[model samples]
Target: MTQDTLNILHLGLGSFHRAHQAMYLNRLIEAGETGWQLAGGNLRPDMADTIAALERQHGEYTLETVTPAGERSYERIRSIRRIVPWDAELAGLIALGAEPSTRILSFTVTEAGYYLDERNELDLRYADLASDLAGTSRSTIYGALAVILAERRRRNAGPVTLLSCDNLRANGERFRHGFLAFLRQRGESELLHWVEANTTSPCSMVDRITPRPTPDVAERVKAATGWDDGAAVMGERFTQWVIEDRFCNGRPAWEEVGAEMVASVHPYEEAKIRILNASHSCIAWAGTLVGYRYIHEGALDPEIRRMAHDYVTDDVIPCLTPSPLDLSAYRDTVLDRFSNPHIRDTNQRVAADGFAKIPGFIAPTIRERLADGHGANSVALLPALFFAFLERWHRGELPFEYQDQGMDPDLAHGFFHAADPLLAFCQDLTLWGPLAGDRQLAHAIFGAYARVQHFLGRSPA
Candidate 1:
């Protein structure tokens, strides 16, 4: 394929995609590969400026990989052929999706973009669905996809693949469910049928710790390349992407470039979500409570590190399905990654969207443990940390501003004020859900929070 004809549209032009997917694509291009180039779509309005900067720079940016020993930077990232702002460029994105040359439509739109509800199901209640239903010029990734799929159905645009690179478990299935639900909600069952029959959503697990670049890192990149890179990304040296080989419109031989396209991505996704991600959140909340800034600082604290290690090995791993690989070794590597001194991954970054993330990353294991006749006494510490954070939120002790998502500030405050009554409150089957209402688990979580209060010396007034 010629340069102009090569097409791949990536949603969510975030740092992680820059370091992971874009980096992998760069490797492919350097090895003389063809028929693959990226066109990024930034969903957020503020990101339009970054997209313009990258486009002006000919889609080149710096990728800095920070290891414990030192840092390694890559300057040329020519795989990205164009940048399209999601709102202003919706027509372009839809056109690319409808193009015969466009085979892969990949997304790293984070967990929120999937519009998942409390049960981790497809959340059609999202406002974007209503907008799309009304035939408005709404420009959500989901909205754009709905429009593109509708056009594809009309044109008989052949089969296409949708690859989800988010942290959601069974990501492809989740995407398919969301897409079909959107179509059905819009009364477009014909389009839904076409999508169900022709489209493929491949499950994938992508791992990397790419933090938004700091000003110092930005200055370094500018000095090295003589170009002002506002969108430079900083990450750890480790990167992995495991995908299931289920694609409708064909895919690049990504497996040749160190991507593992397995027959099943369940094991890989489960392993990463339960182990790496769960541990990361555990450290994020617990470490932040103890006044640690970066993950490395928390890892260096013996008490925090031991707590994280114990939580992973004793509680989290026991509830998981047995893996073919050495999980212990994997745990060790994760700990090393967290302890990478050069990477300043902040607690607040990982700790964001806890309400949405914990249900997937932490709650599944909690449920599994409870089902297996195992008391959640050890696991209770995780929720206790969350409760402590909630208590902090109630007291306005948190340094950064956070948008409250569906969580009632009044309810959170009441929980903190009635710490003595928390055990009974937690027993409220509605708020805690069925899992937390289990007497044994509730008692354990209550006890753990009591301990936390004792350590902190009095609840927030």
Candidate 2:
């Protein structure tokens, strides 16, 4: 064990980070590896209680894992050595990020947080991105990182790896594009040059069913481990992290701890996004419409499960043929993971980002199938389900609040008020991109929407 410790300044300190990436680092440490540590914080001021609790424990927390048969286990995760407290000015986060020892800067800001348009450019329509570009705010990931990188450059912190663990396809490349655009728009030409020469953003695909922590997580931890751990997190027993090996400075030997370090993460990411993520959302939206509270309930429901299975088998598998993975087996495993009753992943959590998911996770399959003159009937059902889910949200019929960061409330509400709500939804450029008003796309969606209506025991719109 060396005295010099390398640091990863993780941007988001949420449950996913605790259960997935930090857990991998903890595994390395547990296996007697040293000189690699994680310092975690968040750009947003949310998760106040969790942050405070972690601070009290000096960044230690418990992680509870459960299997399908309801077997549970707990481990004390001590990888996060520092919990930088939240501040309006982000002074603490910047300080840590600029440190010479912080060799890697990683983030899980969620899919919508990127704010990239269909053209893969940073969309200024988002006020947060605009504010960050105009130097008024640092709430967005690009903004927060801009100041941190500027400070790092000032102190000559040398090179660092900017790893994005988000669900975006080519996440590292997309983030680099947006980050460079943010710098360009902010007129930081010198800093942009420095960044181009000094940083590496490797695309990574992270999979784990880390649900939002409930009170029961802490209770279970106390019962099993005899600890009153307020900051404990829980996830399913399955976990995977696949990263492209393109670090500029240095990185942990993650591959030694069950993390897949690959030459290209494209195939892995595409499969996960189209198969697991899109299907997860499909189950969530369909389950919510049919009054299922948890993801496992929907995954176990024959009808909803078939909807996901058929989508992958019909639309996605064709697009992803000649790939490294066994698509059929992957699909079944994903469904089985979703069906783990012990995880208790919520409908609201998975179903929150319909607007974003449509474009990011589900649209490519529809676009590809249509281009090849193949039927997108199965994949179309996902958007149809989201449309029904959105209508419920519009009518205040949802069992819980629908949280969509990428949603424009005015535009979404206007859909229900339009003369033909379904057609209005079909023409959404943000959702469908170039295929927004395509007749074939609309026809498939309309047909699928009717099936959705029939499934819900309502007359077709």
Candidate 3:
């Protein structure tokens, strides 16, 4: 561990970061790069145990990549230099952010972290933001970043680039909104202005299927290395990151390490949100309804596989900007990636956090289809299935576990129950934005919801 290595701090230590960003940094290191090393902070107390285990192993872990060729495991991933528990070490977390060596602040805190209002500005109503404004020790990654940026401004230090690896569209913009809202609320107008003028939050599109490793995979890694490591991550062989060329401080030669740096990440982000994410939600909701447990099993089923493919190719892809890449090739790759048996991604895991995922991933596409004067025949079917799934999931009738992150269960129930004709649910502008006001589109979606519900029918509990 050399001091000269560039210090990059990652906020969330989830499976996605381990498989995606950490692996990318490792690739750079293996290629003889010296300017990049990673440090991590786990935001929650329960995460401290995992952080401790990774530190005990010298911040080293194995990555098992599953592809059609075979399952290959890489044993030595040395890019991660340290893991700091955020709750136990708040001062250390703030200090790491103020360090001049730290140029990039990356996060995978998921959509919930943004905490936006109806206008999509940072939600001041959030309890954590309220606490941060009161000059309390900020706990969430966004809150911590706000405090760090305020400190960095006082020191006249150089600006830092913030990167959001979450699934939300224009995720960088959302993060900026949340961070700026916190700064402004704290009466730090000058600091807020400085960040607006100096910092860059580049939009990006990232795709990879990294399932939380099964106990068996963890055991295998330990048996292979004669070391007990619990933080190992297993993922599908496929991975892609397309980022807009925007940064305040200098960035890693990520392009040199197979990341695509583009003039605008909009097209790539839109494509992924529509084609990949939308299809994933469809499979997740519908597969669970049909009693399939794993993503690979759902992909294997003749009916479910066709529905997933058609939902993407026939409906979603057409709504996206035309790309030079072969659409069929992309679709084939997505299917193959989902079918990787070595990754046991549960339908339930994919279905988690529907409130955040749907509006960004599926509903936006639905709006696009409607705006283009396309009927809801195919596109509307997805949310219909989703709404149905929500109804069942809330009632505790579905076998899959639902993770709501404090979103009101009654509100979810109301959204499904009140949309009696099913298409009426599309009329809830609060849920679908302004597009929900379009009567023709709303009616079409309602019809589709009705059709799916009719098909499912009332079975014995």
Candidate 4:
């Protein structure tokens, strides 16, 4: 293979990429496809340990899978050609993107990583945005992306595709919108024009239940393969990637590896978001309130599992009708995956980002239910559980450190201190998105909140 084969540069080198995208790319290579190699790195220093471990292993790692019926399997993934070192100034990242051979830059940065505000525009008020505006490199996704685009423009790098693999709806469009606004904020009209003409952002829907790796994964790998792997990651056997058929440059033979390249990813996107992502968060929050540590535990619990099923059946499925996949089967499959006891999916991991999740995962469904004048009982349960969880965080009662990029501790603390805590919670415009001002939403939330309270009264949390 020629040097040009190593062309895809991926951001956010987390476990999900190893088990999902990189794995798909590896499959293409195995199928005799050439001229495509995965180069990856984290934008921030937070995951330096994993990167360092990858360096020791020469960018190869083990992926362990636990089936629904307790079968375990392992495989070595060798698709990532290099780990681009983390640099505070993002010079290395910019260099990677500026290379002529780099045709597609993909990312798995979390939902909150993109500094898009309520209107899905670049949020100028975000502290990192201010820092990036002040010329600090790599402060946020916008910052790193700005530098990369500018360098690519200067180098006259041909058209490139920025593929978003995040869970947010219409993620690619949102990235382009926020990125153009960011360039406008920087007053780089030339770069902005270059970006518009030279780049394409394709929305994608990616799925796999990859939990944070605990010691058990490594132990299992060692016992099975007799190789001590420091960078091993694990996931459920199920994986899917549905991509919108939009790319400025060519792409890997991903379809050969089970990825669906289609006319539009909207139906798949909406189904996964409303059903899998939303109900996952529901089980996470509800499980936390009831002292469950793992997702399967909650999925097995009668009340917690019932809440998730009702949330999907009563409102989410209806909200996402007329889709490509059978909604009912998809819902059942999601529960089956969640109930995979071997996965050990933690409530804390799923519940950590409540502040970032409400708008995309929960609020949209609630807004639709209220707008249609339908009973929002199942949908409203999400925010009600969030309110309870936040109160626990405020009281220092949570078992783990709740990590929310968008929530402020002082402001969160003030929620319970306020005379009308429910009103205080509902008034945060950023949290609920467009539905923040809808009095109907606030009323529905309160009604649901009362039910959660009354249920807790009997359940003994």
Candidate 3: C-alpha lDDT:
0.76
Q: By the lDDT metric, which is better: model 2 or model 3?
A: 2
Residue 53, candidate 1: C-alpha displacement in angstroms: 1.3
Candidate 4 similarity to native, TM-score: 0.97
Candidate 4, which ten residues in sequence have the lowest lDDT sum? 1-10
Best prediction by TM-score: 2
lDDT of 2 by residue, 352-399 (tens): 878889999999999999999899999999999999999999999999
Highest lDDT scorer: 2
Report clash pairs, candidate 1.
Answer: none
Give the TM-score of each candidate: 0.91, 0.98, 0.92, 0.97
Give a tens-digit lDDT track for model 4, residues 323-397: 779999999999889999999999988997677789888888888888888878778888999999898898899
RMSD of each: 3.0, 1.9, 2.5, 1.4
Better of 1 and 2 by lDDT: 2
Q: After superposition, how far is residue 107 of candidate 3 from its true place, in Å?
A: 0.9
Instruction: Rate residue 390 of model 2 by lDDT.
Output: 91
| Error at 387, model 2, angstroms | 0.5
Measured on C-alpha atoms, candidate 4 has an lDDT of: 0.87
Cα lDDT tens digits, model 1, 65-184, are 767777666556788887775565467677767777777888887776677666555555556556665777445656778877677667776778888889988989987887777677
Worst 10 residues of 2 by lDDT: 452-461
